[model samples]
Target: MLHIPTWKRIVIWGLVVLGLVFALPNAFYSRVETHNDAIQTIEMQGSTPELVADRAAWPDWAPATLVNLGLDLRGGAHLLAEVQVSDVYADRMDGMWPDVRDALRGARDRVGTVRRTDAEPGTLSVRISRPEGMEEALRLVRALAVPVATLTGAGASDLVVSGAGDTITVQLSEAEKVATDTRTMRQSVEIIRRRVDEVGTREPTIQRQGTDRILIQVPGIGSAAELKDLIGTTAQLTFNPVVGRTSDANTRPEPRQKVLPSLDEPGQFYIVESTPVVTGEELTDAQPAFDQNGRPAVNFRFNPSGARKFGDYTAENIGSPFAIVLDDEVISAPVIQSHIPGGSGIITGNFNIEESTNLAVLLRAGALPAEMTFLEERTIGPELGQDSIDAGRIACLVAFGAVLVFMGLSYGLFGMFANIALLLNVGLLFGLLSVIGATLTLPGIAGIVLTIGMAVDANVLIFERIREELKTAKGPARAIELGYERALSAIVDANITTFIVATILFTLGSGPVRGFSITLGLGILTSVFTAIFVTRIIIVMWFERRRPKTIEV
Candidate 1:
């Protein structure tokens, strides 16, 4: 009557074996990590003798999935940066200048000669020669305004156009500014994430904090300064028509033009158009390669729209030079030798292999929306993390030992079976975590210690019920069956309520809090399985072998 079917027993044992196998990689963390990294490198860059040796550190057939260590458990960099969202407003006004000029020129008969005037940042102003044409100029400029593309800003114009006397001023509306800030924050977060992920760091947290701030935590990085250098490079690339080359660093350029120093030559500057013919935003792919002269360079390709524009520009101006600018510096200025039809080009400079590779990585990750000012930075050392790990380990060991002794002393042989199930419960928890690639933090270890204490609750209930049943003069097999059946409701009720709380925590929390929820949620499932099925199966098997007339609780 108190027996499990042979097929059911086999299925349960099969799952236990599979879970433990998946969890085996965590026992040899460094070796499996090396093997995984080596395998990834071989796939990306091909294998060398050293890489081949590292790849063989772990067997090919074994599961290589590992539980990632969180930033608190590993040395890393942490930064809180405030995005300069106001910087984009000036660029937005600059972009709208051409449209404003063209609109005003369409009615030149009445507006007379139109000229741009110096205005404050985030605002554009233009002066007309004839004062009587102010109303016409304002009307023409206002026609360029479009509805803002946001839910709350629906039907509101993106630009506010106004005129006084002979001058007309244009600026972004308040609704549009709010929308722009949201977009800027989203783009900054995504770009930072891509830049960090390009270096293959594990479990980096790049999240938006408030209105214009971001929090970044990267594990296994050298320091905060190194991380800042990686993500801070704007990598803004543009191809502009070169106006003239100059040796004077203080040379002033005409309107809609800028002077930038050359990257390869010292004290040499080039004046180029302010507006670019093509930008890095249109780039589809970038890779490191060698030029025809065997020098390190980067090869980049543009999308279809960019390809068409580039081809037309090259075809029309076959002899003119175009400056390739990166972060406001002229990286290269090559004259068009012939009609270049394809959208692909090579960027050659005084670069070695490493610089070329880094350039390619940045280009592929795309440019940041705007600059960021680091407000706070901290570098966590590995020594602190090791101490935390040691403390957590000692706490877990103590909890484990105390639980095993208490269960063994209370329920005698049945209590020993409960201890065995508790061990299996922990193994299954780690196995699940490994399978899901969950990151472990200090709080997550606390959750595991809590799980160890809670894991024996079901066994206690079942044993007490068995004692009660034996006192009623029930047979041994009937008492065991009734004990498990009576305890099932209480076990499910208690674990289900706790699991709901864990789910809520996971849904609403971030960082270490989320890590704790992950372990707690998974521990509940594993504990339930071991308590209800595993320990019961072991007890039933023992009873079947012994066929004892009266069993002690």
Candidate 2:
């Protein structure tokens, strides 16, 4: 009646051994963590003697994975940034100016001379000198509108063009604005992730908080300001043909050009073409270097299409000054002395080495789709995290010791069996955690403590059931079998209900709450296995070896 098949025996013991093996690395936490970091560094930056030595200290066959600590455990900076999604609308309108002007100019005979008027940043206002041709002017502008390819904005045009008397006003349609905002937010998240990853930090959390906000938590960072400096820069670089240089702010630029102030010379301005020949979007690589004058500079290389376009522009426009504009300010307007074929150039300014290096980093990471305004920022200290870890460790030990004593005093030998199973259950929990690389927080530690108390409850139920069966004059084997059989339904029902609750917590919660749910869920699984299978195996083997005719529960 108490017999276990050879296969089941092997499976149960095999799982126990695997759990202990996987859990062993946590005992040597610092050493194993160093080894893991060394391996990753070697893989990323090639192997050095120090890295090789550290990696060699840990065997390859052993589990190298460790639980990733959260921002609270590791010292880090956290930031909540809201992307200015409306910024893209202004840019879209600015870019469409040339197209609108060209289309209106084609119908000059009917619409008279077209002049752009003052309007909001996201709107284009043009005055058609002849009011009779307003319908044709509106038609020409609407021809440029494209369909918004988004779920909510399907089959909608990108722009809404309206006319009032002789004036035409154009702005982004509501559907198109929604589509653009969604795209901008998604691209912002991806670029932020790349920027943080390029800095070589371990396990940074870059997630979207809502429609327009992003939550960034990077552990081991010095301060939130440092992270903001790394990611906040737009770094929008463009090369526009210089229309002319002047000191007058009132000078009207050409229809397809604009005037921008020089960064190096405050009063001087450069009138440049609004359309760029090439932008930073084409850049494939950027690195910090020194110019011929030994000044800190950033060197950039373009991709194939960008290289070809740049080469053609330089070849045809040799001796013409081209302005390098960054963030709407003129950095330099250097004259092209020769045809540059390779699509590589250097940007030099009054930059120190650090500024040049940071510029290079931003270029390599690509530009954000929109500007970000920081809403919240904070730095978590390592000392506070250490205190939390210390408190959690003490609580765990206290709960564990208390449960062991309580179980031992209540069920005697069977209690000792349950204690061994409980120890293995905890080991299995850690083993699963390490394998999945889950983050352990203070709440997670509390979940494990709760699990310890729950783990013993099963053994108490079984022992009491066995005692009840013994009172009915049943043999030790039959009483144990009946006890396990009777208790199986209760154990399954209770644990299943608790597991569902844990799942709901994980789905609905964030951060520390989710961490607690993870440990609670894992604990439920391990405790159930240890209680129903592991403890039974130990009891069956003991009873068979002792050949007891009657036993005290």
Candidate 3:
């Protein structure tokens, strides 16, 4: 019996207390603001560069662990996505061959029947480019305003040749650089969240959880179709020429109306800039604030070219309203008061606190580099999370008490030593989880309970082995020594196999399952140490000091 010093016992108990202090705050992972009794944020208005958020309404502070938790545990939205890999190749070919159109145009004259599709020269639509003869067949197709149409074969010679892939280099370019931005997936998830938040939704969870998938879970949201619209659109941001008051008549009229919400309001139109004058990609920051007159507004800053173009447009259109359109909606039409130099300006509109916060989040996320298709979406409520916590607590209490009773009944006084070891094992596990800031879900709780059974199994195996050795005429001390030495191989073999499965589960499973695997892995490690070391120390101390007569049964 190796008695632990009083100081060692004190240190062990102190560590257990310290662990709880760190783990609880990390479990919640949210900071909500409630105005009066209702939820809200600071409502900012026009022109003011800075506005403080509502301190009284906001949560006291941020939590320690910001890890994403299971939707059922924390109440969030889940979205599954499918990215079209073929579209990636098509977009790449678009930039690589600007001269392909010239070759197609030349082919139309020679081929008797040639048609040009929107598909680039070497892509899925190259058959339409017949280089031998086709002026008669392809000439009338040009009259159609449609983007792409297939041509019929009306030629004696139809040559369809494919590009030699063996000669093609997988070279990257500036266009590819733009297409493959690191935040493209993050932006799409954000856009979907913004699209929902635009309608004033709250406490949404949006995450890029897979190689090419997004998970969004919005609490209290019953319908998610609107989210699909936001995620699906490319939301390409660009600078276009506003049809200034003087140039309105000169602008070419399209079939579409000016797209104003009210008939009485002045019409607004734009000529898409041949190349984007500046792109939203350069926007570094945005914030919601208040103006001198006190209306909701957002302040924004642009890169060099965007600032130059924005200043020029304001100067040219002084005293006339220039529409700030976003995602094709006329968001605001503030009259140009003066040239906005300094690369910064404010956008003013009739907005509430919800609208202001949402806009700020959207601008920060920016637009996705390409389109993403949502395959599935799910939402989990907070009520379910509470239910899970209650169930987990009940299961743990029942399993732990059952294990304690079984160990005490079977081994008598030796069971008391094992129980203490079990207690210490749990304390160490909790302390490690707290320090690491690991998330605990229902599955994770189950893993801990499973560990209790495994922990007792180690002690029970050793105790039964000692009983068998004593029956074979061995002394009590010799029996105890033989029991521990012989049981070591079996315990190691059993735990090592279980450890392998836990490792695989942690590596392959998603979210909650991974949490379960982590807890199980940690428990296996601590359980082996406590079952072998702590229990042995107690049993050895009892034998040495009291020289316990016959097994205390």
Candidate 4:
């Protein structure tokens, strides 16, 4: 008997209804998108009259999840940036200066008057007044070398210390350089992602492309230049002891000090100690606020270790000027009035509210490990994306119409049932995509079109099997039952193999390829359900109602 249990029938129909409900939002994509954005803004910032009106664009009880459009479909910025990993080497050497100087000072009698000397980038050179002290100095510096952390770099030291005559040169070892490069790339990617996400862009792709390169695609941003401005700013903030203030642009600083121009006052420069008392890496939180003068400023808090260092530095250096350096420039040099023990400080400069807010976002996101040079940049226009969307819609409609015509002409009433199931299959696919917040690209559209054709494969096999059964003089219900029973193995085997391929594509591919694979994989699951279960239930209900003694194929 061709029959479905009461519970099974209800479950099948219930899922179909749920899928349609979820898919309904995508039909009104712009309205649902605006509604979702308005709600998110209200949650993040606060409710406003305009925002409230926008939120009411869609029904409050209705589903608000819409399939996110990919960069290609929505139009946005694309960039290929090459990270300057070598830039970190100089900073690394600068950081190690304090340790090296302390080690040499322990044997001050042996290594008389040690001084840091200028050298090439990535290399640190130290000269001693007495040539005889070089051997003792080398031993002291070599002691600071630690084992590399990576497994492949086992037993290898992080620093390569070498000496000749009165000078000692130290640079990162080969293994350490490789490890630093990897860490720098990873940090760059994470920081970039944070910066982009801070702006609340939808589905931005930030991934490492090669050894030192990154690929960024942010949808809804104005241009590539705008995107670059957001992530390219190093935002390296440091607090250093000021050596002196000068008006000469070409002024020379003593060893271990740098001359940086003022951010507010033109032609004014401040010479500050190279080593900072605290860096932005220790920042725990940052927010936009107003200063005592009611000017826009950024407020920041440091971690425990930073707080301790800052407290001690301020306590000892009372009445001395402290330079707040941002990206190699001094933003302000204010005298230490008291021991600021809480580690909370304010940064005030010539800034508007927007600038203050942006600075706060950057500080909270943390600084990039290294600077990035844009190798390629492009801005995709929304008009072009709309054209692509129109073309894709046309292609899908054509394919769908052709498939429907062929099926209806070939399989008669059975084909009509399959067509209905196919429609449900597409709705279910979109529903799953929305639930997962999947991004839809142009290639993803092709996957849906392909799925429309493949959804009828099982129905075709079963209908042909029924035609064969009819030749054996079987009744309508008996032939239909045998057809489905015989076709089950074939349907499962075919779909299983295709689904595995889709999984592989998704695992190995990126960008558009990934979008395609996601749709294809989800479509396979939905098509199988609709073709096997939905169509079968429809045929069973029709058989029970008519009780046909004999039927044409």
Which stretches of candidate 3 lie above 4 Å from their native place? 1-7, 22-69, 72-78, 81-238, 245-275, 303-323, 333-342, 370-375, 378-398, 420-446, 461-497, 529-553
- The true-versus-predicted C-alpha distance at residue 470 of model 1, in Å, is 2.8
lDDT at position 126, candidate 2: 91
Of 1 and 3, which scores higher on lDDT?
1
Model 2 Cα shift for residue 551 (angstroms) = 2.6
Judge candidate 3 against the unseen true structure and give its global Cα lDDT, from 0 to 1. Answer: 0.59
Candidate 1 least-lDDT 10 residues: 38-47
How well does candidate 1 score on lDDT at residue 527?
90
Candidate no. 3 TM-score: 0.60
Tens digits of per-residue lDDT for model 3 on 377-430?
765667787788688778888888998898889888889889888887876677
Stronger candidate by lDDT (1 vs 2): 1
Q: Model 2's lDDT to the true fold?
A: 0.89
Residue 78 of candidate 4: its Cα lDDT?
96
Ranking by lDDT: 1, 4, 2, 3
Model 2 residue 492 lDDT score: 88
Report how far off residue 99 is in candidate 1 (Å). 2.7
Residue ranges of candidate 1 with Cα displaced over 4 Å = 42-46, 292-294, 337-343
Runs of candidate 4 with Cα error greater than 4 angstroms are: 41-48, 247-250, 264-268, 289-296, 337-343, 349-351, 470-474
Model 2, 438-481: lDDT tens per residue?
88877888888899878877778888888888887468899999
Per-prediction backbone clash count: 0, 0, 26, 0
